[model samples]
Target: MVQVAGMNSMWSLILQGDAMTKCILIFLVGMSVLCWSIALYKLVLFSIKNKQLNQVVQELQSVQDFKNLFAVAKKHAKTLPGYFLSQSLRHFKELLLLKKSGKQEYAQGAGIDFLQMQMNQSIDEILHQEESHVSTLSLFAAVSPLLGLLGTVWGLVHSFLSISQKQSADIVTVAPGIAEALITTIAGLLIAIPALMLYSFVSSKVREIEFQLYILSDKMITIARKVIVEDLISVEFDENFMHDQLDRE
Candidate 1:
């Protein structure tokens, strides 16, 4: 194949390059590998979590009361909303107990504040869990280009030194170093271009996820506050519902 010959020719050219060129190329390649690996991992992770979040949100839509919502939340305890709901419900129960102890006024004000605080902490935990390795992608995008530029500068300096030693200027003498410079520049761009794109893409995805979580938190806090302060029915955990949900899962 023509492609095979081109490949061999490129490989030979790379082999002909000096030690610095080789190292730069290798470092660029490694960054590219790591960048792509993180991209793939983030893509898969967000995809799965997004699907799960959507499913939970959809199920929550059909929930009419605190008890049913609590049942659903317990069913998907490992999910984002599920975990947050569990934390919220614990404070909800505490508020109820305090109210029964003749602390109704305190429960109305302090209870809602405490629940929101717990949910905020839960949101941070979720974001931290989902945002792993995103910074690494951005770092590689920034660092790769600089490394490539370093190689190019080194190659140019080497060529000038070579000319001084040989006391001549010609294509044959200059071509190898020029090619090495070009190769590093090309390698840097290759790594940087995709890395920048991946960084932007994953970063946007995370922002969107965070936005959704905030909206969901607001709605949950509003509903929970009403249920607590207005003495409305609250989510009551049910063992039979849990068993049924698990069976469906």
Candidate 2:
């Protein structure tokens, strides 16, 4: 009941603010709404993706063969790690086909470097795509307070002008202006604090996701290397059979 009264009083103060103060308050409210909406969206998205990534990581840990890894990758095809895994596997298959056809040597030398570069490029693209809209939160957090301060200053200036015009310094004349100034100031802080906090939290989550991507990249490279090494050994031991099998596929 007490809290309800306090909220009502705050709303009353907001309603009594002058035109410029009202505009500033409205803008602050809109910014707060957007900030919270984005924050909730990003938080939920990150949570779900993080869970998917952990699942992929667990599957990767138990995967003993390329076939099993490929299956795991396909299962989580919508996730970041799954996307990377699938792309890397596709590139590996292409390189293997080229090697078997005697058109490219992917198991060693410059071929391996090229494959690594392609996989890294794919990882970078996915990372960029996953990090969208993070900057908007930071922008709202940083700008809201300054806008609120502008409103407060505007209110104070108007208050001073009103006092000068009246040729008197009375509490009744000064109170409204002071109220407007305080309202704008409070409105600004209300928008800024949560925005700033969410921005920090979201940024840290993004960084953690990025770090997981790097780990995924390393794991993918390791798997690719192992597959290529085994394939190279098999081809060396039975070039004709391997070429025939690859050609038939």
Leading candidate by lDDT: 1
Please, what are the lDDT tens digits per residue for candidate 2 over residues 1-249?
999998897788778778888888888899999889988999998888777777777777776556676677657755667767666666666666666787544455566677788877876776676668777888887888899899989988988999999998899999877877877778788888888889899888877777776766677666656656555332122244224333432
**By TM-score, who's the top model here?**
1
Ten consecutive residues with minimal summed lDDT in candidate 1?
A: 240-249
TM-score, cand. 2 vs. native: 0.84
Q: Per-residue CA lDDT of candidate 1, range 1-249, in tens?
A: 999997787788789778989999998998899899999999888877777677777777766567776776777877666665666566567777777788878878987788778778878887888889999988988988899899889889988899889998899888876776778888998999999999999988887777767766776777776776887875455656445444542
Model 2 ranges with Cα > 4 A deviation? 1-9, 103-106, 230-249
Clashing pairs in 1: 66-235, 67-235
Error of 2 at 151 (Å): 0.5
Model 1, 88: alpha-carbon shift in Å? Answer: 2.6
Q: What is the lDDT of candidate 2?
A: 0.74
Give the TM-score comparing model 1 with the true structure, all chains together.
0.87
Q: How do all models score by TM-score?
A: 0.87, 0.84
Candidate 1 displacement at residue 63 in angstroms: 2.5
Q: Least lDDT summed over 10 consecutive residues: which range in candidate 2?
A: 233-242
lDDT of 1 at 24: 91
Colliding pairs, model 2: none
Candidate 1, position 94, lDDT: 75
